[model samples]
Target: MDLVFVFPVNLQKTKVLLSELSFFVNDEPAVIGLSENSDKLVWTGRLSPQKVLIFKIEYKGRGLDQFVYHLDPSLPVKNLRFISNIRGGSNYDYAPGVIPATAIEPHDQNNVSLTWDYKSLEAGVPVGLILPSEKSFSMLIATMTGRGWACYILFFISIVILTIHGGKKLKFYENYLISACFGFFFILLAYLAAFMNFYLAYGLSLLAVSALLYFYIRHLLASATAGYVVLILIVLFLTIPTLAVILQGYTGLIYTLEILVLLGMLLKLSTQRFFQNVMEELFGIL
Candidate 1:
């Protein structure tokens, strides 16, 4: 890959500082052939106002994944362009920035040309292109499933506590099995997502698990009211929280507010003597 920076001459001795001009070739640092002073590529030159100075940097790299160019905010850039030739099944995609004046993929040759023309340019966001990867979707699913485990554990604890407080005479093994089923919902969604849309798989898995758990809870507690309560808790604490995690960026705030609201409701309910009386009657202590 090669990068060229063009500077407009202003009839004054100008020194351009170049640091962090390192590139990796085949997962190793590329050999840079430049005179450096204290790890800085110092380019000094003097030219007339009407002249332009061009600096070209060349490097050879293998297995390059992405190329990012961060414009120095202090420098004024009039125009910037990126040109590349694609090969070996490598494709490119860019983020939001100055739209490329030329089409990236040309049908005649496996090459891409992009230009950003500006009357005057100020440094803003970094512009970059991501190289193609095979495991992008798989990695995404893995991350989502890993985070979902936390939600599963939270739901399991809630269920166990609710069952115990409701005075259900269930064995330890049965409770463990119920919790396992709740955790399995996420695993099911993960595999299903590989074959279909993620949201669709998530909805289907949630409905299946919720229905199964509702009936199981009703049978275990011998009360329709207990089953409905469990269902509501699963929806509020498990389903919605999992969705928030998947959405990203809103997970922390959503979870904090959810826990606060739940705690507030618990405190309000605890103040009622009826709740204490029921607990005492069921457990016959405290």
Candidate 2:
């Protein structure tokens, strides 16, 4: 990349000192030189008050993610312009605080040209570009794990409350242990995602946790029917909600509808006195 700084001549100043003129690229020293009449010069001669001063810097590096240009506030610049021409296959976007480009054009094969211009510009915030890359895995995992934890907590609490209301008594310790196991499922998934593909790790983790819960519910209720009911609850409250989260932008709508549908089903079941009769018969309270 090449940067050119054009400073207009100050009539009152007799000489422009080259000692104070310097620039760094990527925190490393850059080659700075003077150019006059479109030709490179080994040394700057006496100050020409009527002529413009141009300083050119040349830099070479790999994986250049960002480039920042800061204007010195003390210097009087009549016009400031930046022209960027990057090779193909690399897409770049202007960072915040950067002045908008005035013109964008296609340069030579696989090259894009970008130009930024400002009249009577002053220094403030630095301007730069942001390079492009693939979607971040850490971000995806954070989204999934956050949603997963919420689903697990809701499902665990609902199941425990339903079991108690059905006249099947469970010790407080048992409830705590079951909930702990359910919460651990997401922790396991978070670690597994580091070593394997996220989707594959999530599926395997869900299968293992679901199977554990199925047998645990069967033992607690002493009925195969109760075990199947718990499995259905897992699918409706946990599995389906998790699928919704994976859908990204649509997750909010899907999760809201799922909660409403689940609530309606519970209300309908309660109005039928289904749970009340089952509790009465199971506990011999009737």
Candidate 3:
């Protein structure tokens, strides 16, 4: 029988240390010649029928993104049981074609065990684990930048609706300035986040933008109008988009719900007297 164990020594960022390697047959320590080449340990030995064999190896490694137990593609496996005790991250998944764990039990804070038991498995499908990758601040900023149009469109639409509903007129240049301010939110956040914590930078950017919008809208229209605009800015620009970033997996769901909620709000507001007057003004009939 030939056996091989592959370690993450060469692939990982940190050094991997192998402390113990042993093989036994028939409850006695058998001296087996083990060959080491790069990250793989290989051994070939003869086995008699009904003779039990056991091999154990221990290693310590760090910063490895994945762990996979490779099985010989030409052979069938029977009665295989694998368990992995994980620390730190909780989110994990299997590689393509790898069978998922049969049980996952949480022992304590930051400790969990994954178990897979199979009576038989065909060749080519191995046990694999995928660790969660940490999100980079730069990546977050990039996502925010790419999705910045959502924030601007929602804010712009709210401004248009509120101004029209309140019977206020906004000059072309005034609309341009408001759009610029909304765009500046992303630019300001990208720069600030590079110097400080992301959350702190985000809060500062939000406050600065909100304050600017509040004063500018109040100057152009009224305090009540400005208040409403500021509230809309917070919800659309800061709250919804940031939440979508934090919950990256559920971004589509969050945005879908946001669109539905906004649609409901617009339908309800359209029935009001002020909005009807604006419709009449624009089309000369309502």
Candidate 4:
């Protein structure tokens, strides 16, 4: 599915782009879970943008995934002619006519060459969307259920590992306990937000977590409070968009992986700078 060229390239931007230009559009609701193939672009017209199509024009080493999009097509001014060459074949093999999935009428093939020299289309056009059948949909649903939730599970596990590693490093219980407890608080906040809103979930939760983190770290690290606070806030702002990316469909899983990596680094740092005397200090160094 080379996104470089589609019906949008030459057609007018109609209020109804895909359905107007293509035949056999259905009224029933469609589900768009995710697309993993390369060079693929999904189309969602009119209805809350919820239909999906994974297009593959030619076999490729890799491709791209796209969400359903609503684009208007009835706008004027463009070329309608399309042509293609067959691999290792004669010129006659290119019989141009009405292509599939397109709404345009195919020119009469029976007519002989007479008045105009308008060239025939040399390629096949898709007539309309061809989605995965019911069986495929059933299988896809199962995969989504298991795999999507699995990401959450893996995310939880990473947090646990980091907490354990961080906890083991402290020679005293007080500082170690506070840091570990705060980290746990952030993890709980993350999944807590996930249930309500998919897109905003990670971002809001991460903000809550990061603010708590940088503040605590700043209080403990040195005496420069204001500058550290400003730096901490700036980093939190920068992290918000990254968390948003994590919440995005399909690819957001990568963002979760990044979170895990960061957690690991955080844990590693905690271990290296473990506070053995912090608990004793709270007791006036005993």
Candidate 5:
């Protein structure tokens, strides 16, 4: 194989998977190519953005082995060890705009359509693993600022609510608060780990935070039930996917509104039971 591309990225930051792998062999590529199944990944914008990494392997195999990983920024060195592996297949689905029924109407549609459908919610990152062979690789690296003020702000609000809500169950909510904060620290972890990506770190944090919320809520409520499971699932469903998108670099209040809308829906639906019991459990309304 003359040209080969190996992908070692955190699946959570999946949107940029192809961009990353493509960069491995292609140092500076003129055109950005995406998987036909792009509608299935976490890609944020158009295939080719202006700022992309470009790399080209020398015809000589001198740099092929070195291409196993990126080394231009620094020399390889032994470290205080921390590495992560990405798991989970592409779970791309209808854009939130699609009706739930119509969205779920089809199956076996994981691959990106060769024909572009801009109206669809397929505006996501494209990832592809290229093999080393006689072919040349044009890698493009995208430098997107994955910053979302709404995520950050809701995070702040979540913290306040947890702190206030943790009356007698301070420990429980404190841990939940920790999970919320853990999401923030994940960014730093992404910055540190080479194979790790921001999406991976952020997505994993949801599971961590979810586990914490489950146990903490159980602790706060002193038991578990159908209701508690729903709460846990609610957090899991909302947080992980939301985290994935937010990590993509949309820093607008719309995200906050999205969260608010979800929370409102949750409140509208779950509040009757939540308020009836929450005040009693947290503030001892009884």
Candidate 6:
């Protein structure tokens, strides 16, 4: 056995092995030692190497933004396993001086589990998790603003490509309308999300904007290329960037990979007659 201390930190209720103020040893009930420190509950006992010991603690508390576990820096850690179950959110981070979890498992919808298993860990490492909190709409909008420049660039490039592929240059007013339709997608999503599920909002926005672009392009170009332009715009300007925004941590890498893939596709298309003609015309102007 080992000495255990539970410090009172705004905890409303605490339990050991599902019993209030109860302790157990080797499947038998045990008494807890009284602590002189009024702020903490302390217990100590001896253990047999042959017997299995299990300690389970349940805490009902609030007011703490993050939970942390401290390990003795001077002692070597062996055969240590830590598991945490979180509900309602998956966006989390590691606290300073804490090692990342070895594995993350999805427990259920809106639940996640993090595990850290170490066979022979050196001294001085601690374990902690910075729990995710609910984000306000303003905060989410700010985050989108910070990471959305690439999406705008990609949207503009798609429009330019669509213009070239149509073999008809877009008038200034037509270009403005394209830009307005693209911007309206985000505006519609933001408003729709306030009263409905996010996925539903996103889907509605995508469909609405896609239909608008299709009809507008079809009216202007009057070609089968309208469908291709809408498809490309949806994938490059909306879907991929939306994924990158949702993943958050992998934003830069996602954007870089997306840009490379788009460039490769453009290079491949450049060998085609229509694309070659467009490129020659574009370069001939210079």
Query: Over the stretch 120-179, how does candidate 1's per-residue lDDT look in tens digits?
Result: 566543555664443343455566577766767766655755666677645878878787
Off by over 4 Å in 4: 1-171, 178-182, 225-286
TM, every model:
0.49, 0.49, 0.50, 0.23, 0.32, 0.51
Model with the higher lDDT, candidate 1 or 2: 2
The Cα error of candidate 2 at residue 98, in Å, is 22
All-Cα superposition RMSD per candidate: 15.3, 14.1, 12.3, 17.7, 19.5, 13.0
Candidate 5, residues 64-173, lDDT tens digits: the string is 21112221223333211111111221233333222222222122333221111223332232322222232111110111113334445544444334434444334555
Between the candidate structures 3 and 4, which one is better when assessed by lDDT?
3
Cα error, residue 86 of model 6, in Å, equals: 14
Q: Judged by lDDT against the true structure, how good is candidate 2? A: 0.64
Ranking by lDDT: 6, 3, 2, 1, 5, 4
Candidate 5 similarity to native, TM-score:
0.32
Error of 6 at 126 (Å): 36
Evaluate residue 130 in candidate 3 and report its C-alpha lDDT on the 0 to 100 scale: 87
lDDT of 4 by residue, 73-174 (tens): 333322332222112112121123323322222234321111111233343233222121112222332343334333434433333333333333223553
Taken over the whole model, the C-alpha lDDT of each candidate is 0.61, 0.64, 0.70, 0.35, 0.38, 0.71
Where does candidate 5 stray beyond 4 Å? 1-193, 225-260, 263-286
203-248: candidate 2 lDDT, tens digit per residue: 9878887888889888888878777888887887667776776777
Candidate 4 has a TM-score of 0.23
Q: How does model 2 score by TM-score? A: 0.49
Ranking by TM-score: 6, 3, 1, 2, 5, 4
Per-residue alpha-carbon lDDT of model 6 for 1-286, expressed as tens digits? 5646453332333321112345555457766555575545455666667665565444422233566677779999987777777765777788988899899998765678888889997894777698766545445545665656767777776677677777778778988898888778778888887656577887888889888888888777887667666767778867788767767789899989988988998889878998788777767755
